[model samples]
Target: MSEKNRDGKRTARERLAVEREKQKSAEKRRRTLIVGAGVVCVLGLAAVIGVLAANAGKDKKGSEEAGPVVAPSGAQGKDSLAIPVGKDGAKSTLTVWEDFRCPACQAFEAAYRPTLHELADAGKLRVEYHLVRLIDGNLGGSGSLRAANAAACAQDAGKFREYHDVLYANQPEESDDAFGSDDRLIELAGKVQGLDTPAFRKCVKDGTHNSWVNKSHQAFEAGHFGGTPTVLFGGKNIYQDQSMTPAKLKEMVEAANRG
Candidate 1:
């Protein structure tokens, strides 16, 4: 063969090899892009599932027919787990609607715990606790409902007040879903004497009071309440008034008793 023709054939072979290499590199890039897209899609799906599971309790109508929601003994209003703080038939009724996951409710409880307990212990008035789950609905977590259910379970064990106080005392950050876990709830129950029993554990884990929690939230909405820590004195919504204080609450109760 002619030298020029041989050289030209070699050059052609070299160019073909380069083209093949470029094709292989492009195919590798394409595969990488496809793999990356698949990974993103999977991650996005996982995030969506996580959000849905966390927010499962946000729906007020969920699992309403799950079981019979037994209200606590002597519970007032519809689906409430009322813990009476004073003597029966005390002239005044101080109704409170609170969510365990609510920061404002925690603050209210802290500020008024002393005065309210003092008045109740003195038999001057009756405080009716109506547990609700506004926080769970507003925030994307089941902590409020789970905590409320646990409180109802406490009611069954005859330690509602003790458990209620401890729950608020150990309340996690409003945004955290720690209370959504039954283990954390049971752990907190240890703080209340005689509350960490087998029955209590079963009730908390099984979500025995989930239906009741839903019902209580229904009642709150039915009553047209705006948010958590709603305080009503003599059927008058008093929590909306920011000026109201613990001292004022005492005076209001005294006057109601006087009437």
Candidate 2:
């Protein structure tokens, strides 16, 4: 072959080999980048899963506590705390199943507090409060159970009614789970006369009445009551009657007594 032709052919082959090497290097870089991106995506997904699992575990633990519930001395009936407002010969008994976190219960307390107290104070009816954890079950928080336990603790300190009133008075919005904090409960106890003592604080912090709260919730379920603020006058569902009013409640008690 001619020298010039041979030289040109060798140069052409060398150039092709160089282009091939460049293409291979570029492919290798792209593959490395794709593999790195996949690793990062998998790690990010794992982190999210870990966080969700931890939160789920925390929620489960919040619902289920250890040990049996110990009812306070003030507890009466089958998992209820009796707050007697009237004389020994009251004509009717009003059993109330309430949750601290229930908005309806808060409204009921606001509308009927005065009338109920007047009737109870006059020895016309006995008010029995059964605390439940319905809100906890519905809202997925410990607020209802914790507040119920705190109320039981208040009963131990002989300030249940006062503390109960204060709790409703300062109740947070139904969606805001403020009562989950033990400190907030203790802070509220300070408003009630003689309820902020060391023993009371200890009872709240140690969740002394958690078992009783659970038992009360069980009682509520067993009773087959529909929801919180279940107002029963002599075992009759007063809430179901559309015509039922706070005034009508008093009249009913008087009429029942006469008959």
Candidate 3:
């Protein structure tokens, strides 16, 4: 009955209005879908980039330690570090690079020290210990720097060897709290015999001798370190097959002398 009905057909304007309403709904749905998809794409890209960045950083840390590289694949570190250091300052030499916090190194020290001392004191061989502890930051922020410096201090007091044994003997388990704190190390340094606490404390606190320790830790990354207790027998590694033991070291040193 209205003017629109009087026209006997829907007015073109009214039809156009209905069509526009349907189009508006469809357009809204399309816009929402586009926005959602864009968000998903951005998030996915960020995740991928994050993973790659992490891997790259780990690789860089590893490579830095690989140079001055000693390949642990053949002859261990024997030829490279000179193992079986002869007693009595003999013809052969045994040099050890060890980390106190390293369980393997401690084990090796326990196993070999007795026999090595017997030989050294008997005037058959000259055995030397090189303290190494630099890998802590890479290994979870438990570097051996504090202990290394402490050993340096002991070295100054002519108790380098004795303090070395005490440090490892009292080593705590690996943890962020363990190696990072100097308190525990200082306390342990006090335990060594013939060590002047004041002089040793000054040496360690100054941190000058830590550089020597850092070098060996750097050796680890290059695969030069098969693990703790890496002994160099006449610059060659004797027990290339397994981690070192005192008995095994004793046998290896004796064998090297026969050669």
**Candidate with best TM-score:** 2
Q: Estimate each model's TM-score.
A: 0.73, 0.74, 0.58
lDDT ranking, high to low = 2, 1, 3
Lowest summed lDDT window (length 10), candidate 2? 37-46
Of the two candidates 1 and 3, the one with more favorable lDDT, higher being better, is 1
Q: What's the lDDT of the predicted structure labeled candidate 3?
A: 0.55
Task: Indicate the TM-score of model 3.
Answer: 0.58
Q: Model 1, residue 166: what's the lDDT?
A: 89
lDDT of 3 by residue, 158-237 (tens): 66667777876877764443644556667776677656577666655555455444554555435444444556776666
71-151, model 1: which lDDT tens digit per residue? Answer: 755566544456566788788888888888777677778778899888888888788888876655555667887898888
Off by over 4 Å in 3: 1-88, 219-223, 242-248, 251-259
Per-residue lDDT of 237 in model 1: 74
lDDT of each: 0.75, 0.75, 0.55
User: Which 10-residue span in candidate 1 carries the lowest summed lDDT?
Assistant: 37-46
